[model samples]
Target: MESPSKGYLDVGHLELGGTIQSHSSKFIPSDKAEFNRNMLSRNKIISVCLLLLVITLSGCSRINSAQGWSGILVDDDRLILASMDGHIMVLDKNTGKHMWEPDLMRVKEKDEKKRAAYGLPAVSNGILFVGVYSGKIQAVEVDTGRTVETEV
Candidate 1:
C-alpha cells in the first residue's frame, strides 16, 4: 500500500506494493489468461455472421420467373404486366408494361423524393387496393382507374 508507517510490508501472502494492490486481482480465475488468448476475434466473428445473413436474404428475394413479381396482374390464368417502382402501371394482359399513366405520376407530384410503391396491386371482385407513399392507401377501380377509397 506504500504507507509511510508500514514500510511497504507484505503483512500476509498479499504483496503490499505497486498498482496491482489497487485492483481486485484476487477475483481473477487462474485460467482466464489462457482462455482470453484462445477466444476468436470480435471483428472476424461479426463479419462471418453478417455474410451468412446477406446470403440467406438474397436467396429468399430471388424469383425463379416473373410469375411472383409484385403488382403483376393475372387474368384468365395468364400474366398481365408487372407494376413496380412506386406506381400502379397497367401491364398488357401479356407483355408486363405500363398500360395506363403510372397511377402515382397522374396524381400531381407532391413530395420531392418519390417514395417506392411497395403496395401489391390487389384485384378482387373488381377493385384494386394499392398503397402509396407516406402511408397513403387507396382502392382504385381496375377498369376506370378512379380512386374508390382513399385512406392516409
Candidate 2:
C-alpha cells in the first residue's frame, strides 16, 4: 500500500491531488500598445466634444437678444424689463406685443460694447429707471420709447 503523501504534491501547505496543468504565458506587446492608443484616442474625442459643447453654449448665451438676470415688472397693461444687451423692452402683458424697445447702448453709439443690465427697472409715475452694468442709469417714459435721462 502506498502512502497518501506520495500521491499528492505539497505546495505552500496546499496539496495538489492531481497533476498541475500549464497554460501559455505569452503576451503580445502590440495588443497592449493598441489598447492604450484606443483609450487615449477615446479620451481625446471626449475632451474635444466637451470643449465644443462649452463653446457652443457660451456662444448661444451671447447670441440671444434678450438675456439678463434682471426681474420683470408688470405695470398696468405693459411688461417692462431690461435685458443683458442693455436694452429696455416693454411688451403688452396680455397680448405679448412689443410696446417699445429702447437700446441705451445704441442711443450712445456704443452698441459694440453690448453691456448687460443686471438690475431690475424701477417703475414710478409711468417712468422706468434701469441701471446697466456699465455704471449708467437710464430713465425712460412708459408712454413712449424715448429715453428721458441717461446718467453716466
Candidate 3:
C-alpha cells in the first residue's frame, strides 16, 4: 500500500489535478450559470431603456403636434394664425373665441404639407392667402372659410 503523490489525486480510476484545479472545476458550472444570468440581466436592462426612449419620443411628438412657427395675422375682426398641424384658425380678435378652422387639404391625403405651414397668412380684399411648406399656395375666403384657389 504505497501513498499517492502530494499534487495528484486518484478517485475510482479517474485522475484529477491538485486542490486548486479540482476546486475550480467544481465551481465552473456555477460560474458559467452566473455569467449567463448576468448577460440576460444586461439585455433586459437595454430593452427597458429602449422602450422608455420610444415612449419619451412619442410624448414629445404629441406635445409638438399643436404648436406652430408661422407668423400671426390680424384682419379686420379676426385674428388669424397658422398651426404646424396644417390648420389655419380664425378667432375673435378681442374675445379669443373659436370661430373656424378651414381645411387646407384632406387630412388623410399623402401630401407632403399635411401638417406643416411655415409662411404667414396674407389677407387682401377679404381673401386669405397661405403658403404650404410643401410648395402649395391656398387662397381662402376670410369670412366664409372657403378655399377659392389652390396652386401647387
Candidate 4:
C-alpha cells in the first residue's frame, strides 16, 4: 500500500466517537505561528502609515474663519472703517447709517483682486490714504467714496 501525504487528514480512520486514528505527519506548527506574527507586524505598520497620512493631510486643508479686525477711523461726522475683506465703508456716527461704500463688486468684475487692509487710514485734505496688504495705497475721497487712484 502507498503512504498518504504529510499534513493531510486521513478520512478512513475518522470515527463517530470523535477520535482520529491516522498515520499522518502533522503540519509545521512553528512555521504557521511565525507567519501569523509576520502578518500582525505588517498590519501594524500599515495602520501607523495610514494614521500619519491622515494627520499630515489635515494641516494642508483650509478652514473658513473670521477675518481680522481693521483699524477704525473717525473722520468728522462720518465713521471711516476699512473691512478686512478690503472694502471701505463710511457711516454716519449720529444715526449709524451707511454714508458711502466702495463698489468692490464692480471693481472685482474689472480685475479679480483680493484686497486686505490691516493698517490705519491716513486722511489728508479730503482724500483718505488707505494701505492695502497687496502693497498698494488706495486714495479714496472721504465724502463721495470715489476712488482717486491706486498707487502700486
lDDT leader: 4
Q: Runs in model 4 with CA error above 4 Å?
A: 1-62, 101-114, 150-152
lDDT of 3: 0.67
Could you give me the TM-score of model 1 versus the true structure? 0.40
Lowest summed-lDDT stretch of 10 residues in model 4? 103-112
Candidate 1: list runs displaced more than 4 Å: 1-49, 52-71, 75-85, 101-109, 112-115, 149-152
Q: By TM-score, how accurate is candidate 4?
A: 0.50
Candidate 1 per-residue lDDT over residues 41-111, each given as its tens digit? 66678889999999878876636523233455565433333233344545456555544555333322267
Candidate 4: C-alpha lDDT = 0.69
Candidate 2 residue lDDT tens string, 1-152: 22225334323332368644433333446767799999999999999999999987887564554455577888889887777666677888999878764323232326536456666778888777777666767777877877686454
TM-score, one value per model: 0.40, 0.49, 0.48, 0.50
lDDT by residue (1-152, candidate 4, tens digit) is 24567555444554557765565655556777799999999999999999999987875554554555478788788777776667777779898888765433111112324476668877889997777666667787788878786554
| Residue 27 lDDT, candidate 4, scale 0-100 | 56
Candidate 3 weakest lDDT stretch, 10 residues: 19-28
What lDDT would each prediction earn against the true structure? 0.51, 0.66, 0.67, 0.69
Pitting candidate 3 against candidate 4, the one with the higher TM-score is: 4
* TM-score rank order: 4, 2, 3, 1
What tens-digit string does per-residue lDDT give for candidate 3 at 29-141?
56677999999999999999999999878866745465655878988788888766677777889999766653233212257456566678888888877776666666777
Where does the lowest 10-residue lDDT sum fall in candidate 2? 6-15
Worst 10 residues of 1 by lDDT: 19-28
Model 4 residue 51 lDDT?
99
